[model samples]
Target: MKGRCDKKAHLTGYKAGDKLWVTDPTAAAGETLQWTKQPVPEYRADHPSSPPFLRYGHTATEYAGAAYIFGGRNEASVCNRLYRYDPYVDKWSRIAHGGMIPNARDGHAATRHGHCLYVHGGYDNDMEEFSRDLFRYDFREGVWHACALCDRWEGMHRDFHALSTVGDKLYLFGGKSDELEPYYSNRPVYDNHLYVYDPAAERWDRREAKGEAPGGRRSHSAFVIDGKLYTFGGLNCLAGEHYNTVHRYDPAANRWRLLRPHGRPPPVRRRAVACVHNGKAYIFGGTSPLIGSPMPAKSPAEEEDEPPLVDHSDLHVLEILHMAWAACGLPVPRHDGLETRPLLPRPTVGRRRPPARPKVRREVDHLRRSQSIFVRQRYGAQRPPLSDRHQ
Candidate 1:
């Protein structure tokens, strides 16, 4: 959150939609925001039928007034196409690489500083490999450059992990070397270590995170505010479990703390993305299983198909000012900061609300409320927006 403007900011977001949207934290509470869907340019004038590039597992970062998106996949394969979206112009232009382009990949992470766009670790299909190389996309020069890796570890090649940037440092949290496949008897293994790369110092440090660290996970999301790192919701494939917890790490203190708040909480989910606007963390879409997975469902009717795939489109805001969670909707025109009341929570279009939960004991009754919905003292809110179960 250091070096961040204290006013008039928005969280840039992209997901199931092939376009972009942003959350203006300055808007009045619960008032729908006015967002425009931009036009994606045609690669060729004659190719009018060509589908626009829509992606997940891709990385988009704000740099020098434009949003730079790189490396992701569609239904059939991975992609290496780099794009720039200039909000001022409401247009998206593909930036062709002059020389060699890095391998096309998805599930990678990227961040920007100054004019440099840093991309690292994603699953590359062309080589049938996971990339260990760090690539820099220099907008000023319109060129692609690779960083010199030092004492590389196998972990550097992982995808689906949480990669975050703060200052000159790039930090990677828990990830697995493998993704889930139907017949792989061995479940995915997650890394418990933390890797920090100081591009300025030209250094990489792999060290065990101290204190009570969360278990290894993948497809999780993280963001930095005021120099402290905050991580949220992820999947533990080995156990087929998803986490709904929030953890905060203070590097200066080298410790972790779990945040349990009295507010509407989102449902357990994974692979969702997040951005920090104002001083709050806004989390968006990610995939989750309708039910815990490992073995198929016991019901023969349900066993005929795979577990329901949950891709959420709902918007959620976690006030960094406080740790409380609440559901958000489309943005409205600029206004003063949202007040505590005057908001109506709703998931994105066509999302079926999560099934009801079984009753809990009296002692922990306060924790089950939806975080997106504004309830009483003890609350809970909406979870990720639902997606196609078949895809």
Candidate 2:
């Protein structure tokens, strides 16, 4: 795709895998979007389906023409099942991978580096503890393994953070940490620091990033496009506010810029899944801050922490070429606790037929030609499996 993926945030459409949508070039001709979800086949016994409960902190990444879903929580408990969805065949399969499968958990970040899926840092609901360990799942060979980190966790453990791959290094940012504080509080501790992991070296370096940095946030979304890293919409534990601001990072130069786009931006949301397709940034269903909720109290005496959440199934698309927000003509989905973050890169596959509208494709193509795009930059070697050492 000529369009870059550096743009952040997403679109409205399928909230819980029901609707498939694209922007309405017509609306943006002065517009936003008109979207529709594709029909998913009925559930199968041999194969796994996108279950309603196992979505919290789970991720979906596109690889080798298929989208894979990894570890997340169901209502009753966390699961380790790995499911794959094929757009071309309209089918789902439960891939059986052998080796040291990571413990089932939620709020973990999964990223594709080479042929393996790297899962790190999540809350082990069963153990009632947080995990900062890294595990590797090799798709081609169907094996789960471990990585050689600097230490047990290599650093601290966090959940609801964002992980994006730039070349071979993985950039992990933000998330809620329980390690901080005086306890007896319901609120979370948020992290703003950035950590870069190099697979070849099997080490992580905490970079002291300079320039305009994004404030501490968790459950945010990020993607690297055109060699720049972009972030948007995360929860601020201290401020007690979900963010709407967008920031861009130039890794090579180590700088940050606040992105100011024109037109309507999506309302403040958290846990929204973000991805780059063609050239636009897609934001799917997420939890929006409850309107008319009481403000957080300033002290322990008048403590207030609960933020009522609203169901959000709308799909919103951002035109990366222009930094403007638009819409897709799909009804906002109605679902509570829709876990919609990508643990994998979202490809331009599985998208239903675009609405027969004029100027949409043409305009997008024009922008593609005019602006730079984010093409995949392969970095680092494939993570070695545990068997390598014994061999």
Candidate 3:
């Protein structure tokens, strides 16, 4: 939590290569103020046809007053386009092309290490074609370079893995080969092998861990906060099991530990993406099986009871500095310093009410209570909005 600030003097937006540790904004505001005064902020969504730049399986980072988004699928095709979004100008400009750049890919992993962008293995087209090619893009030099191709102990191409940057090394884990058909398997196959790539030495080496590691998963999310890699929620090997569990990896110890929380992680989903800002992990839109996937339903009753799912447009802030979670709806505004206003919370059923019924009129009081209950049941509860689900 060192080097973190939550006061008005330090309420800046998130940027890559910025401070990895920061104070929890909601927590720093005090528990009552966080929950009652500003439960969750509501941010309006952009138009549906905004742009194809920040589509599926891509990565984005903020730096130098601009947001850099690159490498994802556009429509049904793979894209290698690099785009820079200038908040000052409120516009997006194409900086690079997708022509023969990298394979048309999804399920790939990308992270900003130092001043360069590092991208690794993902599903090339279908889940069958996995890519192990590693590449890096340097904005300062305006160049791209191939780093390494991933391989298992038996020399097979692996994909659908989790990659993260911890300290100076890039780490990869829980991947399966292209030859492995995930659809037919009862559970996701576990590689249990850890691969580390060091950019300084340009060498690849395997690291061994001493504890129980997570099982093989595809489309899982990993982000570095306060020098630790926090991984959460993705598809597990089980037929219908989507992970809501959280795990933290300590690079120095080369170990994994489970994170316990009060409730399930939002809802079980996959292909989700996360980025760190001010020591908080902000998660945005991604593909979910509820929308597109090939799997049989377990039961009609279960399906009937399932809550409606959508491509999330909301942003979730995870405070790595204090180990907290808050649901946010507003787009990360392009403001910094003392000019930013902490977002106001979305209204809950408990807070808003109609005119109070007089105590002398017992019938009116009963009617009011019944009305409130009916409204609450019908609407359930209002959570924050998903303002940046992307076009």
Candidate 4:
């Protein structure tokens, strides 16, 4: 959907497991967030019966036709159930579940390459303990098994490290390391270390770096495009600030370079999810520090200027080739690569029915409540009376 340019972020909307794309709400009709002429659909679970919900301690990775979410802490407790979302059906299915199930934890890392999903360290319920044991999930056989941790990284079990796959190997860089001894603090820090896991050899190799790498940090997001790893936005350990800088790592050269991101860089935010589709990177649903002190008024002043709105729903996209970073954004000197295409599609299922308005829930009226109460909860609260708000 086109939106006003004044808004700084783009966000996605989800209904019944279907995710829809829209321009930044804060952008002007033609100026601000400009969505593609087409919208892409994200995968949904096999079962659509469950109300849409967000849970913690879960790890999700996108593959051919499904997004797999497994082993996360929900409102209830740490769960081992495995759920797969199908973009075609717009539903979720709980499939086979058996792996070297690690202890229940959150903020872990999941990266898929070839056929296996590599699971890494994360925090436990207490938020004190961190796990380092590595697990592998085989998609072909639907089995989870533990793999050996690098002898070099044997001591500390950390979570929230930047996880990205380059070529057939997986690279994990910088995150909060777990404390193994009582004398040390189990706090998150900016780790400068980089480790590579070779699935073929089933071993971790510490890369020999010749240049600067992204500083030690956590909750940052990273994804691979055309064999290079691109990362941006994450929380650093400090009074509280989100990063806006972008960086790329080349597995071939064993080096890193900061890049100037394309589109409007998303506001400095942390703990957001980002994905690569059709050679572009899309990020959404993150929290950032407010730019100024919040006005104390209970509500907006009807007579004064309108206050800006904020939510964790802003969506941002980076056409990787359009991004102008040094050593980035250039056409290949050769033409041997595969033709690019979008990984997902726009959803067609679960269409929205026009609001059965004229029915209001005002304390003084009852006939205006003909539609389901839940629908009102979802869209009615923000609009004025139906007559005036309808477009």
CA lDDT of every candidate: 0.58, 0.59, 0.50, 0.53
lDDT tens digits by residue: candidate 3, 6-27: 2311121112112111223455
lDDT of 4 by residue, 1-391 (tens): 1111122222222111223333332345322344331233343444433312344545677666566776554333444556665545555566665756555555678888888777887654332245666888888888889898755644446666666778888888766652331011323345667788888898888876666577666777777899988777776543234576788888788888888764457767656666655566656555554456232222211212112223344446676777832211211110122112311222221212334322111132234233323344554222221111110
lDDT, residue 339, candidate 2: 29
**Candidate 4: stretches off by over 4 Å:** 1-53, 125-128, 179-186, 293-311, 324-391
Q: Report the error of model 1 at residue 357, Å.
A: 42
Lowest lDDT block of 10, candidate 1: 381-390
Q: Over all chains combined, what TM-score does candidate 4 have?
A: 0.64
Find the candidate with the highest lDDT and give its number: 2
Q: How much lDDT does candidate 1 score? A: 0.58
lDDT of 1 by residue, 113-193 (tens): 567777877765444345566787777888888776734555455667766776678877876553321111122447767
TM-score of 3: 0.60
Taking all chains together, the TM-score of candidate 2 against the true structure is 0.72
